[model samples]
Target: MATRARGRGSGRHDGQPGHGRHTTATARPARTRNPLVTAPGTLATPADRALRGKAARTRVPRSAHASWLPSVDRPDPVAVLERQGRDRLPELLPIRYGRMAASPFAFLRGAAAVMAADLAAAPHTGLTVQLCGDAHLLNFGLYASPERALLFDLNDFDETYPGPFEWDVKRLAVSVAVAARENGHPEAKAGRAAQEAVTAYRTAIRRLARLGELDVWYTRIDAEQLLPLARSTRHRRRAESSLGRARRRTSLQAYGKLTEVVDGRRRIIEDPPLIEPAGTSDMAFLRKIFSDYRSTLSEERRLLLDRYRFVDAARKVVGVGSVGLRCFIVLLAGRDADDPLFLQIKEARQSVLEEHLPSGPYVHHGHRVVAGQRLLQAASDIFLGWMTGPQGRAFYWRQLRDMKGSADVAGMSPADLVSYARLCGTALARAHARSGDRIAIAGYLGNADTFDRAVTAFALSYADQTVTDHATLGAAVAAGLISAAPGV
Candidate 1:
């Protein structure tokens, strides 16, 4: 096995390749930067390292890569969509077509992990940390509680792992700035916003160092605290209101939209392709497996679920970035068709974390994702769990979007945008502190200014490449090398 190739269950095994955490923190100097970030991240195993050859050439600084990203005229946007869709097939039902037709930028937002692997592997001066691999402008957001309290946090952790801290921080700064530029903010203004994100990250890292290790581990950002930190009375009042609105965002709420009551039977509404059931064979198999799945759950959970009877299910497509991948939403009905419960079981592929770190003792990749996500996120879906089926494929289950919300990247003014950037910056560092040493990280960062400069340098440069990649896909589409049904 070459150094770059992480194999099945390779994530839990420490024997093979790069640095990574398995289930907990490691005892090591946090200040050490991986030479691989600048060097070739060649795995000890040649076979794995061979995969790194896809785009090994050196190019201009990442800051420069952004200039050409917006030139959609140079690339065929439709072809890019087709390439993205190609990976998402056999599982995509038709209802998600409207979502796929959402802007190219929206698609880019969902696929940031795909971008991170290409960018991080390009240069390997191995600055490693517990990275939020899918960091981007809109991924940061607020969630509320039953009592109507709002808390800010990093909402996505599907791609979090030990990797270059630069990758996480750079992705955020560039995303916010790039997103701002797309919204027509001035260049200098956009640059400053990016800088503020770096500042917040630097500031947060130091604060994390001050907390007791266990205290830091126990901390969570509460939604109700927004009342005291409110920038204005109006802001406070609005937060209080949004909190109330959040309570209604439940599985019950979602069930009403996705299913219906037809003569007292709770069934999913099928309008052509939008939301439909799986084929008869798949459904028949699932019916039996769901009974088996119930036995696998804890007695308490099993009893809780016994209240709801499993109904028919379908492979449902969801989210812009995940439009082309395998995803399904299973429906359950209790007592009456009106009392519905929805469970989202998304396919868990190997994480980008696996590529950077060697696998440990884990036998399943889904276990790795579930374990890593539980460790990293301050708030997680209550139903989070992992399972396997059909060729031993892995999947993690959760409530799809229970009270889930995102930042208003398009709506925020420059000032509010900077404020939001700072929020993400702090959250990213906090997540890193969970498995990586914050103090050693702070020492390496050493007063923040220099680290901030390096981050800004990399962020600006990589943003430029995303634009280039976008254009390359565009050209492929125009040349008829790929099939495209744009604005789907």
Candidate 2:
């Protein structure tokens, strides 16, 4: 590993000196549970048609972008995927793991281009905004601001780009539909979740139209805070338990594996093929770079005058969809072992926004990642910065996990799903509204149902198509075309 000319102690309980909301005006701010939604039973017949049509030509409505290259009508589903797997998958791997959990919808996540291509095939209402392209079910989560105050917001930026705002909503709603299917909910009920989500988004945007811009920026929607809104005792309790757990998370909670420490000579225990330690020399260079990391931060942010130094670093695989990617967590120490700060630097691959988007090089795609993350997130990592790695790769750096948390879809019931989906929709709207113009989009949506119905139709259609693709993936696995864990 190369070095960054900056330094900070690792294993600190809270965060780096000034991450998240503590920073001045900059960047902002997956999974479903269940397995029984059948394409024939859950999706409208048209969705199956969508699943089947991968080669059809499509177009974006004139009002949306005034651009000519991208179209909305979809191609045959089978063929669309053939092109994606051949052309896109090779590049996106080392993708965030954990995202491709044990479901078809989960698998779709690791394949962002596949999702983008599928989304491109859907109908649009011409409403656009900067979108967090990979807004899957599990993506929204809670994280501490530099103040250590926790807030719920978008947590991933690998696919951030400007596009039809509806693309994010459609992707989000369809995820609800698929997750509902997985849960064996009736298709009608699943459709309701999708409907509720869009309605919430529409309503949230309109609500923002009434608030001052700064208010929008300062507003933090938190999950624990929603417990009061919970109508049922069950939801309230769950929310409380979840919040309690989140509030309790500290650096000590995360650094349990490496117990043997003397002079901060820690050893990270190997978790099999998943998280084995690299060579000793490899770690030394990583430490050397930790000292260099301090220079990477703006001098203003590089305060505290060196109370810490880098001690240990290791390779760690995390997130379902992001499992194979090059992810490293460097543990730092200042004055003592307990005062540690853990910084993770993950490789940022090209966005799916690249191939489908109008051609132009993203001068600083890493900068774009940092900027988009700051824009969309309520708070961000203190050490958040971008760097170029060896062998021509780009990476964005941040704290390993400071009071980081997420809503667990696996544990949610339908009513919980409804409330959570609404929360996500509302948050997504706020993110878009803050990053772009709420009025223009609201004007495009008008006091009408055109945007709602079009995307609802599209979400249902694409979800049906996703199941077919999932089956194809299953077949490919069966035939050894690709590989994943058996019974996955």
Candidate 3:
């Protein structure tokens, strides 16, 4: 079970340095329950919730979030990454390092653990939410909902957990700053872009707070609704093209690109070190786990799944932080060979945020991820599920591609980045509003830009720290302390 936020003046009991320290406030009756699991009719009134939020500010001031000095005992970023890779595939560690070393933004993408540690060191608003723990800029994207509507929302939940709402906001803001700087924008523009994200979040939360429960829960950002936000003809055209491309990114597309006929059967094409034929034992393991995975789906989804027969499976590498983990792609054919379905089975480890926050209400990491995705996403894939594989390893299953697309942050202009950042911010707030105390959070934010400015300042400072960390990783690779396979 997760621990509840302590009342003011309770002091820290988690044993982490600089955690849960409130400067000026009185203790209230401690609500020792997971905030996400409250019973219906048990929640406080809107006014009371708002007052609770305002009280949090007296403990952790809005201005306090601006500071970003690294402690003398701060863990070496490279060492922190190395520790995460200790249980992963040894041959793939170089790829993860090489990818992260490409740029500071890239480093930030793969260094969730490093950032989680940093965020934990600071005092935060106890306004808790089911965080999109890796809420960086690229992680927000367009995906087809079950109704086949294109919706823009957070697409990653590998590190999702119940934590201070500001943690996700801070990470998103920092990503915007880093991305703006990487695109050659001036520091002032970068800071403004970061602030745009926080501003959108603040306003969105405040609006959501005024809404009824069902209204907040049903809120979504439709992709079609985003077209009007494109200020330039070129950007609108680009947005339309991206959305069109995402619509075409289905199982049929993967079949055309990733498989070919062998004898009378379709087989996955081998691309060694990235995509390879699963060995005999691996194939047997997956086949056994297939039943286990199928049991996790709903009855209707199971019925839908039963119509398909497995065609091929391949061990595939994916993502920066996820590169070294065990991941596989399974191809299934329905009705005819032309009717294909591709499902990805990715390994799920304990989240990086788990170490910093109280225990999450999940023993299986895969279940944690799947539950988080279901709770946070406005609309989720029908095929999302989880199971325990061999050796008690947890794995989550989902469609390899269901009209999924992400913005190209590197190519974005300054204004384009700010608009996109705000869009991401809006999407994130909708997700948080569904699971957190929005009234309290809104009360904390008030109607001012104080939190926005402070977080923007923190984002700029953190971007600087990220650049230094990227250089450190580059140095390690150059000194042969760590191997890197660039351009992989």
lDDT of candidate model 1 versus the reference: 0.59
Off by over 4 Å in 3: 1-17, 20-31, 34-42
After superposition, which runs of candidate 1 have C-alpha atoms over 4 Å from their true positions?
1-87, 90-104, 122-128, 144-150, 227-241, 271-274, 288-299, 335-338
Candidate 3 C-alpha lDDT tens digits along 223-246:
999899888898889989999999
lDDT of 1 at 176: 76
Model 2 lDDT-worst window of ten: 27-36
Stretches of candidate 2 exceeding 4 Å from the true structure: 1-101, 121-128, 257-264, 280-296, 359-362, 486-488
1-488, model 2: which lDDT tens digit per residue?
A: 01111112221112212112122322111002111133545732323323222111123331221111222344443344345444223433323222343566776666566667644432333334567889987888888887787788888887788665767887888788788778777766676677678778888887776677799887778655777867888767877777778776655665664434656567555664555575687576565544445665777657742666666666776665555566777666766777776677776766675554433225556666777888888777777777665555666778776777788876666777778788889889989987655654554555555455545554565567677767766666567555455321
Instruction: Report, for every candidate in turn, its global Cα lDDT versus the true structure.
Output: 0.59, 0.61, 0.88
Query: Sort by TM-score, best first: what order?
Result: 3, 2, 1
Q: Clashing residue pairs in candidate 3, if any?
A: none
In Å, residue 212's CA in model 2 sits off its true spot by: 2.9
Error of 3 at 334 (Å): 0.4
- State in Å the error of residue 452, model 2: 2.3
Candidate that beats the other on TM-score, 1 or 2, i.e. the better one? 2
CA lDDT, candidate 1, residue 57: 14
lDDT of 1 at 350: 58
